[model samples]
Target: MLENTLAATYTPGVNLKHNVAGANWTFLLPRFALDTIVCYGVPGQKALKTLARISNNLVIVAAEASTQTMPPGVRLHSGPATSLPLPARTVDLIYIATRDAQRLIERDGDACDELARVLKADGFIYTEAGVSAGWLSQQSARLGQAVRYWLTPLLGEAQTAVPEVDAATRRYFVENDLFSSSVRLAAIGFGKRRQPAAEAAGDAANAPLRTGGRSGKRRLRQKLRPLAAALQQAAGRVEGQVHLLGKPLARRGVLIGPEVGPGIPQYLANIAAEAGVDLRGWRWGLAARGEYSSRKVLIFLFPPDEQRPSLIVKMVREAGFNARLENEYRALRWLVENGIGDAATLPQPVFSGYHGGLMLVGETIIDGTPFRAADGVETGELAERGLNWLVELATTTANTGVASAETVAAGLEVLLERYIEIYEPGAGERAFLAEQVDAIRRSRQPFPLVFQHGDPGVWNVIVTPDRRTAFLDWEAAEIHGMPLWDLFYYWRSVAIDVSRRQGVQDALAGFERQFLHESPLNATLSLAIRRVCDATGLSAALVRPLFYLCWMHRALKQATLLPRNQLAQSHYHNLLAFCIEHQDAPALAKLLLAGRAEPQVSG
Candidate 1:
């Protein structure tokens, strides 16, 4: 009875496209329809909006609500494109944009039922969707909390004990739906739809989709890649409160900013008094703001002068306090060597959480005298310039199209070697190597742990116009267990350099090539040393199996990482082949042949 009323009362919306007396469906035949039903869920809004603007008889049904109060001249009703609100066999044509089948299933099969009812026996349904942003069909601890959240809300009493709807909401999707068939996780149907009997039964030659439409549609979907990336980048903004401001300072030729962080103004004042610069009488202004995570920053401006323009004050949050300082060319030198350079020694374990700091100082000849003192103290240049140089080289590689692998590897190698130099083991290098190796071998591969920049990619390593390298985003620095861990973590960044051919190989090659061309002997010795060092650390007597297993596990786990890190796939396959060729598991022939999988014994 309801269906009969719906059909009798169905007064077509405004015929804006064909309002003339002579106008008819013949002009729009094969292209236009009496009604255009758009399925909108997840990301279908874009397409729905586009079609609504260009077509005359367009209507949108909210996927979640199953109903809508559309604009004048537009129809609204509950139902999927395959099904309609009118009758059992009414819809002349149906259109469904891409949406998740699992999500639709969670909505109590309304999508499927609507499609089944409204789609005419001889009519057709045009639909599109992809697995790109679809949800999981099942549950697993490894699948993460987001999937669980998405399912929990829509599933309602079906997933729990709320029991409000049908007695079969939960089981309906898994039991009989064509789209879903699992509990913990069954399948992910990104964009699946049912065609009317005619569309489905059409001969291969008469197929409307035979004109390579799938490829074109896929290309259209790929256009969302940038949007996805933008969303990912903005994800961080959602979590934190950020503030920005401008500050002005009294002096020129000053690169003012935080060194250790927000409190540096006190320290800078002391230095100014020592330098006979009466900052007490100088009108220097400071501005500060903070991100919600306790990371406060400061910016400063300077008085314009003939020799130097306005200076900017900066601040950084370190060790729970706002450490403030000025950027002086000379001060920058001091910080680089002592704070950054000295800290670069390999094996010189970071004081765990002490992410490195930077200080800047400038030098200028005041009245025929080269001013060497800041806060009336001396500045060091050797260590600072040296570290700065290495940073420069790494940045250059990153910008010159060297693969991310190569640029980051070079940085990590430099960092590790510097740590080794600074720490200076009291015992022989070999003895020390043996102990560390044995300890590491006995334990599971420690997750990356040495405290270094958490994200050591190109953008974070900011370079100045004057050729100085200043590392930003010290926030992500962390402690991972092995030097190689840093290398491996950095290697993962090659995904950012996807445009390069053989990106991974070429990136790894960058480190080697740079070494060979600039420091051949050092490069050769370093490789030999690392092989011995790592071998000792793992304590796995046979290099082949240990090497292979280590790489294989990393690849397996990383290759399938969420958000689809493509670089891991290439690295995993390449290293898997390498490991297979190198493995000497014959010693464990019994375990392999008998299927008694056990760790291969190592000396």
Candidate 2:
């Protein structure tokens, strides 16, 4: 719920689209083989985006066409909730807000018969109605002692008085990490309802929801969940606290990871100062905190008057996280020196130094809005921009010699071996993985070596309204990697996030649609792929192989970060496994194996 912090950063592009109902979709969507879904009343844009992506027959029902808004693929039906446009027992899912439920209620105060008439027996009507803002305040006092409230003051933590905003309850989201968009997480929130249409027909248990038709007393917790930490206990005035420059910075909650020392913040401020940046009154927020042992942390120094962060400070949490920060520092310096910074819109490095054996690198924040997924046209444009930048970087940094097939195979094999070791796949899984590696080897292909933006996930990207894109988080970049890694990675990353809430199979279906099927965006993606191959003398035959190999590279990277048992939980592991399982699945096989023009193996 870092809405405030994200707003301050100017990058809350699509994150705001998600709401309490959208959160419910994580568990809700995966349960059904959805074809027809009636979004009763107006749900958030996130639900529509998700519904549109998963299935085509998403009909938004409302009182009138004038009252409802329709996104790209969905239809709009003018009707009351009591009488849906669809036939009986047709819709696999019915999503309605509790207020809408109350509005549809007759003197009987029950509206589920019409809803039940249209929904399948096994289908779930996922209804989420929120309590009042006052309810949140009342519950804040009842909050568990999750916040010891403060760590040591020496670590730059402080408890301050509440700011003017009523968001002391926000710390609950922070401690809970409600900002996470990960799909597999099983955490359920308070007052969420999941009932069958048949079962809910006569239920009065849901009547309490009908009592408040949003009479100004009710609000979704998601909408009111501000970005703050720790409510004020004694004065009954809700307040949150965190320290900025060792003094109490009112209202702002502690973000990810603890500040190492009082001197570190000063040191970061000093770097910005030396770089001619004046952040006297700027608020410093911890944007990311990595694994426990490898606590690499990212701190954003938000300028008081500006939308974009003035400076971003990244510090090493431990020895395991050291090299990447150092690599990112070097990568930024190299790009700036080589004049490739603007092509990709990379950050400008300000200063680098070691404090207490942990490395901290300060860089000027890239100014733009974060990229939003689910729209093919915009994503297509983003793909073109990202791929075009990759081409320029390759031309600048590449040796321009044919990449040795043996060298490529060796690196691919190392990734394969690591995957086997970490994931310990079944025999079929292992054989499919080996066959994938062998395909890369058999292709006597000599692909161009490109400077890869290792993890070009959409979240790492932020764009100006004009579409001038800036890429962030360069810790995973490679000096000389296989061509099209960034392009493929960008598309896969976006699809994974889009299909994530639906689970592994949903991701596979999305992949098939994107890579194999003749999708609207596929042409855009295909053209971008062709541009890379055209620029580097690479073949289309290598496209399928390279696409498969990109996941291997990601698998290796994730293995280094996540522990053994948790590696399977990683998105990359699941995607890689699912791809192998469907190796010969009709569409993918036809796409990958057709027109088998060979690029010769070095062996």
Candidate 3:
């Protein structure tokens, strides 16, 4: 009768399932077959009922007897977590809900050891718990205390626990050395460990037996191995921390705002004094607002006083642009010495230097707000002033030697090759783009090189209350380049920003009409380009090819700089589409034809 009852309890086809604490148990099913599975701290009768569906053995250990009706064919144990009523090395798997496991580990020091006693050599115990931020240094102390307090007696040696934070939680896995009657808790985070196959095989062979003998001393020593390793790793971490604490607080190439000392204000005052500016009554304070960017820009406001005019002290903390800062400082000095623009068109620099590895520039604050494209009159005025400034910059820096047509073409070819290698365009497209690049190289036109603002987007322009435009962010200024580079970037940025604010299709339609000379926007950008060409004595034919080349360069740079950005991806795709449609243009036509052919190579 007992044999018949046992057969009835476990059927042939059913699978066990349980759910607790927002975690699904079905997902944790092991690949290998198991004769027995145990779940400690089963939360509800519903979970017990689910576990009963197992065709094989199932045990549910509850903290107390449930008032709900018990499920049939399920073995239930009621006891404290520290001591379980199970034989050694008998269980195939153990599942503990996160919260219950934490409580057990905290209250009963030998709780894990008791679980380890009943687990087979290859058995797994799974539990996950949420951890708060700063848990590594702050919360680890308490967790370590609990582990050291409870696990010492079971292992016959003190254990040092290292709490590691990963993906905002902590996970624990158990490996039992049954020969020594000791357990090792492997807490994984931040780093990985690799064990050799030979050592692993040796360890498996040397597992301890339940009965003690003369090899007891060897077993105890083996048990202390994990503890010793843990302590050594902890010592390394502490040593690294001590070394870091001994260094100066300042970062290598960036200035942290809060770490700024009281000496900075006095330093600025000295710079102003050298430049014949008095700041006796002015006080410094950080700007209330700014946009997010790669560089940390702290705007220091110097309110107008009876002694002198108001000033703006801009501190630029940049790790990536340290070299660029030197170039920009020289550019600013050139602008001041050459008298490029009045205060309305540019901020007058009173002083410029470095402090704590950060680039600092003090300038008379231009009384203006960010230029708004929606204001028609201001927009037109901005464009006119921008064109005038470009002309002045070109004329002033005209002595810089021009880049030869061959050099320009070679650069474009290199970019095309990189694009093909990275993106693996079709054979037809690649051939067409290659042909276009060759045409750009062959079609020679002599053009003078001039200073160019590498990034002259609308965001860098400010419109004062008096309707004058001021240019900002000259860190990317080039001493010599194509004059059209800055103009193209500015218009492109305006189009993109407008498209983002409005609908893409609507904005594109408007911009397309303007490009086709069907609409007038901001004094006709093409006409302004023609005027610049006429002044510089450059060929009108060079405009179309050069413009396209500039776009290609910009698109390629965007892809290289921000490979993951969706907007950059869209911009590149759109440029390809434009080239395809404008096949009448020699370069575009070649690219279009190439795109039509079969792919010659695979990615």
Candidate 4:
């Protein structure tokens, strides 16, 4: 019977990593023909492969979706650790392989409860118990001596003790009388104790008393409330749709829900259906969750099946930003019409509209992955591609307008005022910024505006395995902006990446020496500048100041909006320092002098 159960439950074809400690489980497989096994947390690939060879049914659950495809018979479930979609008391064995067991338990105590509840009588639980040096001293002498004797040689003379198990976990298991054994680095096992019939009955009898004499009633009421609310919400939505039938829907500002719910998928499916696209076989999974901002941007993926190509559904929700989606939709259409970039490099907009206060955009998924500078691409090659893209964007689009010196100066002052209000800059810093603003105001040369991708960081660009690049996130694209702004911004991102990889001091020092022509990065910058100058007949002198202006603009903008962000603060401070050191630079020097002389601008 055990052999049959093992054969029925063993999963096949799982590949496991060889380095994990739990990979030794293969030797123990002969002892028990387990009926069901669950690999929780991240298990070793080698261990999983060995388990698959022995077990027919294996389930792997984790917080994030697996990047690799699962082999046949192995199932992957993604969700918070606190919840697992499994029947109670059905699992025969549970394996949790993680370095920090206490952290795991603390993060999701309910998961531990679920593990206990699901294990059948006599079922086993295996985990890593990483205890420190004094850990054994606190335990029973017999167990402590045995563990210390076994582990002492492994610890060596320099290392007198090592972590063996977490105190809280050991107590929980010991108090419950479930701990079976401990050997080497692997904690052996625990079993669920079967409850006696009389004890169970007594507990059942006292349940109502524990709940103030309304156990069943309270349970029933709690369960019914959610169902009632769901039904009412569904009915209201249906009525709202019916009422809007054949009527022009008014454009309402952005609407946002506090949390994402099941209805989101259905709402998106309805939108797809309205656009004559069938998504009946599609399953939605979250692709990305953005940082804290008023805008809630969620990217969801619809994996390709037999009938349709893979699709990406992007939803942007905010309290009052209704026009962002509209802007993106129009920008995409314009890009497609102008053939600004390769067809595959651009998002093919399928359907875009607003629903339930969300700005929804469905586009064909790009088959590429996000580009990383460390991915073996030569620095010059990456810079060339990025610069070429900017050039293409600038040259292909017609000039919208010329932004005058006064307009630029006024904008900088507004941003500076906001920054001062939030950051409370020192007297010297405030005076310096005021002078820089004045210098910008003094420069009267107007730069021609071109359509610009407002945010062009490496993360926003997707690179195919074959080295093809495509840009994403067009919601912030501006129709009228200096072409050099995008180029300088892209350069700033590369510099930041370099700073992150190499020490900040090294990168900043490199920037100081190599910004114009000496550094490799400067070569790319020079090439981009030369190309733009050739294309637009703009002088290097005229455009040089614009780069500094662009950096200041970005720094001020980020500082004003995200005052608490240390990274933004660092960038702002760095820019100020750079300006102070290089005050001889024409545009920046003028601005600094002006800032020092000008009266403080009011909020």
Candidate 5:
């Protein structure tokens, strides 16, 4: 799991290094069978960690993570690269970082020969480092054009073409940043596959969640988005009338990316081939990250049997997607450690390494009915259950002390900037937001924090056979986050599907009712939030402040992702505006916080 002071940091320039390095190495190993592999001087045991998942036969000659415990399948072999501890012709692959390879050769002058001793006839040796090492390393030090990694074929030539690092990724890095290209990143590279014929069928499958932009310009268009997505999926599998009809109907926007774009099915097939799988008779699905902001795609490889799905790969084309994917990987690991990883409703971590000049995480698929707002799943019970789940997470991961505003913000500088830039807040709105910030932040008094599934809307939920609710997308989660935001955001979303469906006015009115009314559900929700606050040591006084902060954060984050024309219609803007108006309302004060979290029993 990746750790940072705050998860929001993005250093884009590092993309020029070894983005596709890991995939190249994995390509040399057996595609399906578990092969015996050795890792010598892998920087972070990143290769070892990923190898542990796929291969049962793994011997680690050396690694930077020697102090850490090895996973069940991995064996930590102690010895220098020149020595032979293993039988000859037994190893399938040897992964040595270029620096380590260079070190072994310098010390004994036969590291490459010793590595070859254990290799089978078909076995290969892979070495990769940053571009700092010149192309092919003819004489070991001088440059000859630019290259990512080098391969040594003990038996013969490499099986597949060498992969190219993503050149497009350079746009993300700051040219003037001091650390630019200075940091050495280690990744397991895969061999490149022959590019096949292409067409795009991704938008046709996961459009609603896959792409974010303006809602349909017209009411009819808005209503047709789901139909269009359905059309795309239908066109992929069925033949005859359904396939013929779907192709044209979905062509406009639903199947927008598929018709003229790279064939996602073929793209996935190439990915599968790179992984060494005979992926015939499989039903594949694709979910593009964000229409414009991200080229990260989630490829769902489904078995012909059509159960949920067998594998889900979060692959990135752009650098920003790496952070989000890595964040979700860490969050899932944290969940697994904290006892929330049930196979029925959650994605089990499978692989976390690079492939095809991109970073990807493989995981098991979630099985259940989706809880999308468009599906009209607006149940008060779901809100109650969602809060209960949030409370349980908070209680399980509860920390002891209060956190300051700076800590809670968690490197959201871009978010702050985006909020100001997009909203262009007038004096009155600016002052109101500013006042809320100061009032909550000025005092030395601190507020408690907890683990928050940052985007806990109904759309990210799934329900199992036994009626258990499970969350799906967790890329936006935070380890140290303000409590109550998840709950408020959740119920607010639910309200939009429920009584707030009429217009923005009704939505604000419904938001008020959820917090301030004396109904049974409201009372229960208030009690649940109070219990979580008590568990996490959150003060009642900070409740109102945190509520506005959460909405502002959501609004700002989504604003950057929204299409320009859709900016004014962002759901969070109305919600945030509502809270700003009632920031200090006497009734809001009584219900949202109160002198203490004293429960108002519903009569």
Candidate 6:
């Protein structure tokens, strides 16, 4: 029946812009049920093409896009969805079919702000993606599914199954905090999410798959360092108790370590201590849960269904606990506060560490939410969780009609601005850093410094049931030589994220400076440190050469570890040389051309 509803009325050429698919509210009627529709990423060609098919009186609303190589039909517009150039209370429907979801969403919280500004009192929106997961699965292996078009195909097919799929899809659209409320989604027709297929399996593929020398040393270090830390913890250099407490909610029992155990009892005691009451008999339960990092059980408990902390001390207690949870930033901020992340703060035992295995306790309330501050969640896990939390929070905000890429970006901007003020940039270096930004970049840096899950893409970022942000996988983070190293990484991720929405546009427009500030180590600082190392005659042989060598190491790793894509590998190689090589321009150019793609496979 649902299929029939779609097949009978929602024909290819039908104008469902402002009208619900099975409804008689034709979008063409000026004062009809459908009063307005907003469509983004529309150039003259796309507009004409879409307009030619539908009989709706839909006004084509163009959001920002690259527009550089846009076809003759796509035209530029003066307004962005985040900060629309439209009037208030004028429309009934808004459709955004553009890329740069993050920016649009960030600017105006999933167009909620815009919708509030422009739509009539009871307006509704409809959206269809331009691309989807199904379409992406049909593309090349190495290229992977670009995020931009992936959502489109999914919606297109869903439209075929449930004429009312709009509600479900729209729910997701809102939940993920997509930029446009109304959209066209492309679908791949009931296809399973697939892994990369092997390249043409034959003689040509036998070109002696080359392998790089050895991460043997790096791998050794990765193993050895963790081993040493674990060894030290075992020896009681660290203080805590370890009990194989059976799984909180299942068979898996928790291995309470000093990191989590000491803190829990202390946290409880502190809560009790502040309340001037005894919690020695307070009862709670542990859920057999592990964090994003490890496979250990967690001590999870729900407060007595009605138990609540007193309000006055609540703020101070939470502040202290949260301050502990935010220790990484605290430690890093200490350096920056002392103007340490800056050049002057260097040689102060630059500590490179992370926290992971986040064991968090949360409830539906904003303030009562709990996070693991002491348990050994490495930095990678922290960064991963932090980024993921932000993404999910942004997505949630988008769904509530309050989040968008721009909103998410704004939140990030707040954090970035905070970080920058802590470590203000040098004038000369700021200009140089500005030049390195690309109109299109994957969060994966071309410079190939460690693949520190800087942006962690969107999925890794998490949002609590209530609107709170937390990153997972802090251990996945790493130090890099380039300034704004995370910039390209975060940008690339935004590119993928936006491309998934409508089409791609810049995510770093107003966000780059924040990253430059947040990075404890950037190119300017690396250069300054290198000079310091040179001038101070630091005996550590690895100091100066290690900077350049690290880039080479990252470039080589990208070449060998990433799928055999010429552009990706070549970009890293060029970036590596830019930081390391002291050769003439011609040599650099030669390296760029060294891995020129040979077009070995055809789709």
TM-score of every prediction relative to native: 0.25, 0.53, 0.48, 0.49, 0.53, 0.22
Global lDDT of model 2: 0.50
lDDT per residue as tens, model 4, 264-310: 24456667778887776443333212112223344344443422236
| Weakest 10 consecutive residues of candidate 3 by summed lDDT | 165-174
After superposition on all CA atoms, how large is the RMSD of candidate 1? 27.6
- lDDT (tens digit, per residue) of candidate 5 on 490-528: 766565445433332234455666555555555666676
lDDT of each: 0.28, 0.50, 0.46, 0.48, 0.51, 0.28
Question: What would the per-residue lDDT of candidate 3 be over residues 64-95, giving only the tens digit for each residue?
Answer: 76576766666778876767777888876665
Model 2's TM-score against the true structure: 0.53
Worst lDDT 10-window in candidate 6: 198-207
- Estimate, for each residue in 161-215, the C-alpha lDDT of model 2 and write its tens digit: 1121213223422332312222111124332321111101111111111122443
Off by over 4 Å in 6: 1-456, 460-472, 477-481, 503-603
Residue 4 in model 3: shift from native, Å? 86
- In lDDT terms, which candidate is top? 5
Expressed as tens digits, the lDDT of each residue in 203-246 for candidate 6 is 11111211234546433432343344345434321111111121
Better of 1 and 4 by lDDT: 4
